[model samples]
Target: MLPDEPRSSADPSPEGGPPGCFRHPGTATGISCTRCERPICPECMVPAAVGFQCPECVSRGHAGSRRATTRFGGGLAGDGGLVTRVLVGVNVVVWLLAAYVLTPQLGQTWSLFSAGRDVLGGPAGIADGPDQWYRLLTATFLHVEWWHIGLNMVVLLWLGPPLEEALGRLRFLALYLVAALGGSTFAFLVAGNLMNSVGASGAIFGLIGATIVLQLHNRGPLAPVMAFLVFNLVVTFSRPGVDWRAHLGGLVLGTLTAAGLMYAPREHRGPVQALVVAGALAVEAALLLIGMSLYGA
Candidate 1:
């Protein structure tokens, strides 16, 4: 009689295929890929060169497998942070509240409350009043409509998790917050006359920017990501009602932000991270300067 699979109950008969061993009689021999957690059957189970890996593991290896010249972090895959998820949750909640809580009258009244505006001029954004600047952050959590909220949440959720995993949670959160501010600041400068826009697209685009930088810095499975970014940018340009400027502004700021973070040497201790953070802020300040100049002129 053929030996049973390591985790399989059924034994392979003579006419059947190769012999297998069983570590568990009740369970099947199928195993999960060590890398991606996909299941792999016997025929496909190449002798674990390094060791036996299931299909998922095999595929992950393929996706992340770097060429000889690739840099570090090139073979990483999977979500490793919670910041993106929390942001997504908050955005979704705000959207639901916007839709369900607003009575016709309340909707009209609240529209002005949540809508973003230029604080320096025009209607002044929601938080333009004393101690209201917090709205700068809150407004990011707000969305104007179903489609607006839905699309943003989808992108935020999809991209946020993976990117956060790549960068630590705190760093990822910082990235999102900074990106949001960068986008808003850019909007404030570019929409100089009188314009108001609010959404999480800025922060979402920031994640995309980080992904792009990551691809450039360390080559790996970036084709899918690049494709996604290109498609979104195209849609932003092609479609009506899309704020491509804020998107692009966020993209540029985010790219720089990611680059700043990546280049800042982490070798130094306590003071080094602080220094890096400061440097990133200074870079952002410069960007804001550019925006202000553009607007002033």
Candidate 2:
């Protein structure tokens, strides 16, 4: 090349015609990075407030690029809460235990069986049976079928992040656990003595219900949430071997729980949330007693 002509696009232009890209010698670049003043091709350009930047300058802008957090310190993606993650982890761990260890060695005691529902009258049985009372809580975490757990987890993952961020960790966890209990209790109330069930559907449904209530309270769109609930309920009733009773129980309980949270006096929200949790436990107890009475009768 002559002295007046640029050797390559990567080299600086002669007589200010256009500078060659630093990285690609053959590509001519007219613009220089505001920070580095280096000639860069279109591919390397990173948009900035003042002007475009080269890759090196853009890479060091981590501090500037971070968006402000919410009141709860959540990130731009609403990812500060860990309660949802912990709930998922617990469910997965318990599922693994049930599938690999408990089911084989301990049998179906971990699952919710109608046998657990006890009565003081003619239904002379164990409210004290081997792990019977505990099954309501434990069954929520136990899923023998691969697809059962997979579908439940996918739904939880999709719904958990935003709800957890909105409600904070403790309240979110309370709602989920309570919903699980409610579902299992409902199942116990209706199922035959020989019937058994296990899965996280109750908890997943609870999250769905909670999300709908929360969005409604915030004056956000409601149609989508209602549609989701309606679709899932329809599927629950139509699908063979699916526990619609548990899903309905969970949805109702979750909706109540979220409503309690949203309506409480702002200064006393924590106490109200705790009270709602207590009420859920009370409802579970009441349902179990009713179920026991029916079984005994």
Candidate 3:
């Protein structure tokens, strides 16, 4: 038989006030831990299967039991979509700084380019120099136009949360960064060296590709997602001033990254996921090197 668990009693304070939290005696609280029955204030309470548990009880329970994971090996904690919200906030902040504070022309410095040129009476772009390689990632977050950022953020908010929940936060972030790099590399290789490209469309397209792969892995319905992807592809090719190369590169790399995560062997999932992201980066680097050499920069 299981031993009886010790229960804490909610005793009144010496001052004759209502019972206070065990952790913070100065704060009165009516709620008690579900398991140990210790008094817990709102901040100290953690939602449990039944009622709230104190921080200590929750930690103990977690230590004693295996933590739950998503089907793709991601921890269930990512269900809150905190990373997605933060990404949106960061994008908005960067946009505000670039558009208003620094001036849009100056913001173009963050754009991806294999070669630099004068635009609007100002020198812009990285000039295919190795030192400013950060532009590959930064360009993903830089957007000057309202509609451009608005559309990308909406897509990111729609797709990022579910992907984060399925793949876990770190893996999801890896996928995003790698896809963004892939898109930038592709743009650098294919777009005119003097042409500058900026926006999160590539990363957003990467999310779309990852979502499609995930849906396929889970045996979920494919028609809706496929239709969405097709429509976007059409828009990509049909629209002028849109960099199709970035979208294509992001989609290809993101799909490959998700496939690696979803199909990895259960026994070696973590290492394989890491390898997949690393492989994608390696390929991007190799492509960039070859492109640079061919461009004679």
Candidate 1 overall Cα lDDT vs. reference? 0.62
In order, the Cα lDDT scores of the candidates are: 0.62, 0.75, 0.83
Q: What is the lDDT of residue 97 in candidate 3?
A: 88
Q: In candidate 1, what residue range of length 10 has the lowest lDDT sum?
A: 68-77
Best by lDDT: 3
Give all TM-scores, in the order shown. Answer: 0.60, 0.67, 0.76
Best by TM-score: 3
| Cα deviation of 40, candidate 3, in Å | 19
Give model 1's TM-score versus the native structure.
Answer: 0.60
Instruction: List model 2 lDDT by residue over 1-297, tens digit each.
Output: 776853655455666667777776567878888987888889888899987898888878775785553322223344544777777788788778877877664336667765433423322222433335787887788888778788898888888877777766666778888889889888777763445677888888888999888787788998987898899999999989888888988888888887886677766665776787899889988888877666633
Give stretches of model 1 more than 4 Å off.
1-79, 102-123, 126-132, 269-276, 279-297
TM-score for candidate 3, please give it: 0.76
After superposition on all CA atoms, how large is the RMSD of candidate 2?
11.3
Candidate 2 clashing pairs, residues 3+ apart or interchain: 9-20, 9-21, 9-25, 9-26, 10-21, 10-25
lDDT of 1 by residue, 1-297 (tens): 345634333454345543332333333454544544444456546556564675555676789864431122222334454666777788877777767875343233333132223344423433244243354456667776888888887888777766676666666777788888777656655563344556888878888888878777676688888898999899999998777767887787777777766655545422554565566567556654554444332
Tell me the alpha-carbon RMSD of every candidate: 12.6, 11.3, 7.7
